[model samples]
Target: MPRVVKPKDVRRAEVLDRALALFLERGYENVSLNDLLAVSGTSKGAFYHYFPSKEALVVALAQRSAGEAFEVLRPVFDQPGKNALERLNAGLAASYQVKLGMGVPEPIAAMRSLLMPENQALFRKIVTIWEDLFRPVLTEVITQGVREGVFDTFDPEGVGDMIQGFAASIQDYLVRMFDAADAKSRRKTIDDCVKRLKLYGIATDRILGLPDGATVVLERKQVEAMMTLFMPSRPAGSLP
Candidate 1:
């Protein structure tokens, strides 16, 4: 019997799945087109038929991941009969659950890689994509909170932008702390995120499903070790 042929979309997904695994195992910069083709078990011609280039593949991966994340929280924002605070809490929880379920570290590691000077453009693009995807949803939620008297922010849109910026900064800080192998920095980063959230008029109880004054204890050594495995190769003494 002749070998079965996969559909174009199926083949493309297979390539992406393999490439994502390889990129997760090795940093994005370290993974070449040849490496992707080799791991994906697809001919160069077939790979090009889908991705065109490695950068395109990375962009697709980022966009797909962001789209999935947005979809996970979209229902929470759209759900009726829930107040702003409840909806916001549900959105946050849904996001956390999705990340947990994915169980893949490449998305976060890829963001860390984009922070490098060489990948500045890609990083900016990713940030813009995230802002575009999240800002309006956040603005709607904040506006609802303001009308419901649960939140008293004067500028809902500005607050949404700030929240997105704060979240990005926190993610970057966590990656840096992990790269530096500093447990204290990791702890401090979490504390700083909480402080900033409170400053934004987000009630502590409405954040991350954590109670007010809840203590967050992370196993720093283990997490640092895990991050070290994914840390991009850099010159000695260079900041992450």
Candidate 2:
């Protein structure tokens, strides 16, 4: 007979959700294991059993984040008649939209933390994970575009790197300027950026007629609701 599953997965998932919240509100340096335990409502022993160290937990979180992102875009990429560039751009835009709603302070928050001397190695490992996820999809798109004579370039590997860089930049800029803590400014920034990105496209508009689906607009609403909840501003000149 098959063995029954334990509650460890459930507990670990709970811990991760709390950890992500704390990490979003407070950076990695500010949050301690004690903080994680308190926020997660789990014991130190349980936490340690699941995650031997805070770094280990963070590594798991990073991997999960990247994996989740890939899953969200896989559907778009698999759609018929969508060229590599179309898939690439759609993926980037949709992912950014979801992230904007989800209270991700920055797209590269985990990567940025790794930029420090102590975290550089960890950062590299995470980059490898992301690269593995993006490289094949990007390369295939480039190859297909070139075969169809829609694209001028033919270097799949270089094009893949460019795709990753472009996505990262969009995230960094959107999160910093549009998704800022302030509500009014955040809304304005998001409105402007969304308008511009929709026009210019994220990567290259090789494949024609890609649909936006519900990801961008729905996520934008979520952000608006979050801003309302946290900021709760009133009409101009209303307060003394």
Task: Point out where model 1 deviates above 4 Å.
Answer: 100-127, 145-155, 179-240
Candidate 1 local Cα displacement, residue 76, angstroms = 1.9
- Superposed by TM-score, candidate 2 places the C-alpha of residue 38 at a distance from the truth, in angstroms, of 3.0
TM-score of each: 0.66, 0.60
Error of 1 at 27 (Å): 1.1
Specify the highest-lDDT model's number.
1
What C-alpha lDDT do the candidate models reach, one value each?
Answer: 0.64, 0.60
Least accurate 10 contiguous residues by lDDT in model 1? 213-222
Worst 10 residues of 2 by lDDT: 209-218
Q: Give me the displacement of residue 37 in model 2, in angstroms.
A: 2.6
Output the TM-score of candidate 2: 0.60
* Residue 129 in model 2: lDDT: 74
* Model 2 alpha-carbon drift over 4 Å, by segment: 1-6, 102-131, 175-240
